[model samples]
Target: MNPPSLSFRARARLSRSAGALLLATAGLASLAGCANYAGIRSDKQPLDVARIDTAQSLPTQGGQWPTMNWAADFGDTQLSSLIAEALANNPSIAEARARLDRAAAYAAGADARRYPRVDGHYSVKRELYSGNALYPEPYGGSWYTENNASLSASYELDLWGKNSAGLAQAISEQRASAAEEQESRLALATSVAQQYNALAREYALFDVAQAEARERQALGQISAARFSAGLDTQVETRVSDTQIATSNTLVSQLQGSITVMRYQLGALLGKGPDRGLAIARPQMQPLPVSALPDNVPANLLSRRPDIVAARWRIDAATQGVTIGKADFYPDINLSAAAGFDAFGFGHFLQFGSRQIQVGPAIDLPIFDAGALRARLKDRYATFDTAVATYNDTLVRALTEVATQIAQIRSIEQQQHDAQAAYDAAAKAYQLAVIRYQGGLSTQLQVLDADRALLQQRQTLVTLASQRRDQQIGLIKALGGGFDSAPPPRRDALDAMTSPT
Candidate 1:
């Protein structure tokens, strides 16, 4: 369509209409920012299925995530000690704590912006005047200097809640930052647990390798003796040597694994990975037989710190929209200055010399074509992005819970099957050995049965280890019972105790 040309009055009317529309749009955008219509829907959809009752909650019991002491769950005192050390000295945790402090300070500053800013001032000077002075003049000059000092104070009245919105946004960001720090802590603790478990498994593997190597050495000696007596062939002796060599090679590989794990443990504890800390070999805990909670997936909203952080980000974005729209309206600020004024510093302390001033100032945007329009659009887009992010995080959290549940169930079945197989193969190996001694079975048959039994045993051990690790992962994913802790009442940023 072609644009229409207009007379002066018509253009003025059109401009006013356009301004009104822009202001209206900006106001709507602000509403959109403060309220997460999309997030509410998303949150509600899950709540219907999960039956979440936020209002009916009780205080956390003693075994809650924050209070439970996860290390104690494993019955490992050494693991507990290591975790304590990591919490105290880990660089990442320290950095996160510093950031929390910074965020809290920023929130405080934002809040204080709404209050009056007061300051004291003082000055002293000799006067020189170019023009004739009513009282006295030191010299006739083109320039004049005089001393006057006064204390001043100013305040911006948040008539439209703009300052309030700004403070709210800062507070939301502070909460988000705190949640992020807790997430980091959970990640750090999980890494330490996983690494410690890996080290234990490697140590077990090393022990297994050593035992196999000794067995192979004994078989090799027996074969050598038999060959010298002309009862075994040279090929049998060669096979025994090969077996011994393979077993020794495996032992060496396991030793290498032990060294690497030791270095990693050292690094995780914030010691130099290679040389700062001694590698104290820890006793591995037996696999936990505890059953997982049936309502694990439903508890994610309460447990996951990242999800909570995302929601706070959404709230902050919403408040940002409100603040942006408020900008398009007239700003009302109340400023006042009150101070003692005197010709000399000695009179500054006298109340009679004080001068007081007070007034309200209004800033009306007369002709900034579309600056506020553009800003409102930007805030709308940011709000949309925050909503999207929140939805995405919610989906991921659900998937995590489901995945851990499935993994744990599957590993349990695999462990059971592996145990049965190991038992059967062990019996077969015993029979084969007895037959070989009676010259009824070949050495190869005995070897095959023994290898099968070893394979089953190794698979069971690996599966058991994996099952334990998965349990730890599931607990970590569920925010490790940290959700049971009460939220902070203070505006100051506190250490986050959320899940990763």
Candidate 2:
């Protein structure tokens, strides 16, 4: 085969085309600033997921994760109903729903640019003519009418993919909005659970306080009797009375705390604070210790709704950078109008009343005092911000899971050891009473043992309350266990064929 070379004219034309190509390439390459921003999809932990504790990841799914009623762990029907009601009616959820709609509408509007737009306009006008104007000599200052009817249409050529970029940004934002709504719902549900757990703890503490007060009074009475019988000194009675006063104060304080917790719980239920007083106290149902999923770090990044929303925002920002760069080129649009127009009424609908006009409009970025460049810079910075925020969110989530897991583990041990201490104190109180009755121990000694037993019992109650709260905390850290709704079907074909 023979080798062929370009002639003189072809070579010159080719050089111009190559120059234009280089200019366009340079413009787009400026937008490659997108490469500087970190991606949200990479599972590699930021600062090692902030050194997350591996012991308490969320539970692994054997099947699809359940429609997790996390509050059910407490075995309380009232609590369950409260959670369900809050999800159905909370104001925050309503606001999130409205935001989702707004974002979807914005996305739909952006999609409109993918097609042509047509509009119909009609107008009738009557105006008085000046005597010196045309036909004024024949009919002085007479009124004349004009009529116009037209169909005007316009479509963008999308030479730079600007319209598509806008649509992509909008869709990414809409996905982010949906994720935000999920997060809000999860937060509301977890808030109700936390308050409900708090109410339970307060009630348990109240019971312990009441029992301790009762035991303290009994000891005070024993101390009084011993002092009168010359079996104990005035110092013993003073110590007993002081102990009783302290116990009484604690009982009052616990009563106040319980009332406050009830008020807060009622408010969370969207009821009056007075309603809090009317609600029944939760029973001492045992909360089971839960196991974290083996893939704690990765599971949190993939499953947490907040994390998902953050990732979506990063995508939106990336598309925004593209949109900003696209503005550096010319915008091309095609418009057409066809219509009937006339000065005379009868002839307005007849023959040459019809007219048509069509053309293309082009807008080139000639000069802007560096405005476009500044805007592009801002878009890149915004993308950087989104990436930083996403990494920070992952870090905090890991820290929270670790902190909650550590607390739960520590509280469980405290619970076991406190129960044993209470048991030992109870036996000691019994032996002291027996010895005092046989005159082997003083009445003061018996009173002291009784006081010690009450303290240990209170300590055990405190541990129980802590365990319950931490268990709820652990569940919340795991994203409230809401099943992930499937990602919206992309329908690439349908999306292409029907932008609207």
Candidate 3:
């Protein structure tokens, strides 16, 4: 016998059950066809500060990180002002700032993806119907106008954390850009200070050259008098004239170098060469001796802008890997639309012309010739590269600090020895001049003493310049007074991918 006819309520219940069964079967089939991403992962890891050997080069006590106004310690107000100007107007600084803004904009865009997207659309068209096939009677061969207006909305379920991971990645990149901007500022400021120090060295050498020239002119006069009294030959006067000419040439070279240095300083200040001309002679005090701060490599991660930027990039790459993994799962979206459609304007707003749709859309990643696997592999590789770069930056930063410290120490000793030598040479030149006047020594002896004194003076000036330069180098290596909190730990990053 045929089954009994079902009541309306029973038929409705039966229909609901069938729909649920169909949806469940489809979900299982989708899961069975999903692409596998089991073993593809990044193996690279960041370097541990404790594992790297510091070799006792960096002192772990009695030191502090450089202050923001570390340049003031050099007692040069002009240098500080120039650094400030460069930070404000340098093209590199501007570029970095623009990049930061771009990254922030990208981050904002990514954030917007987490919320529902709504769009409004309207269109009108006039068309002629064919007299064959689907059209019939009066409708056939008739011209009609169509109107459509829709308001549609969609929201991703984010069950697999794809949207969240993407937002996190964008935020990390924004932070990295911020750190890089600071890095640019530090580089520009240090450059200005180093160039200014070089300019001061040149000026000091110029003064010595001018004094030597005056002494050579006096000696030339003495040689001419001796030759006229038959005490010396024309050879002596000619040698004295050559020495005076050499001194004048040195003075001229120093003057030219000073001008070039000023031009360079002007460029660093983001101005024309004329701007550098306005810079006054630097009245720098003695270079202050500084020791390395405590914690050595451990604190360097936060102290160095480059290192901080690298770390942030690694965080961004980590999020990229999360996003890649998320792609292997299903993407479900809830979408709804309400609209009006009509053949003519008379019926466009009528209730009978209203249309509505609401449903969940699912996108399953099935077989695609290994495209998904390849994408995941690329993300893993990118993560590995970011980790490697961070490691390299850390090692390089530590090496720079150690190298500058060694140089500074060596320069200090050299400066001490050079000062003593300069004092002795000065006394010897004085004695040689008195002896020559008393006819106890030859003109050649005074000339030799004068050459020794000039050589010593030049050495002293060069060492002083080197000391100042290395001091600046050490400051830069120590992160140029950059200070910031450390990036989020690994656990924090993992928390981002966890479901709410």
- Which candidate's TM-score is highest? 3
Q: How well is each residue in 169-277 modelled by candidate 2, as lDDT tens digits? A: 8998998898889889878887887787777877777777777777767767777877888877899789878877887898888889889988887777777889778
The TM-score-based order of candidates, best leading, equals 3, 2, 1
Once superposed on the true structure, which residue ranges of model 2 sit more than 4 Å away at CA? 1-67, 133-140, 217-249, 483-500
Off by over 4 Å in 3: 1-34, 228-230, 491-500
For model 2, state the Cα shift of residue 422 in Å. Answer: 2.0
For model 1, the run of ten residues with the poorest summed lDDT = 491-500
Alpha carbon lDDT of each predicted model = 0.68, 0.72, 0.86
Report the error of model 3 at residue 41, Å: 2.0
| Tens digit per residue, CA lDDT, model 3, 391-465 | 999999999999999999999999999999999999999999888877789998999999999999999989998
Each model's number of backbone clashes? 2, 2, 0
Candidate 2 Cα RMSD (Å)? 9.6
The estimated TM-scores of all candidates read 0.79, 0.80, 0.91
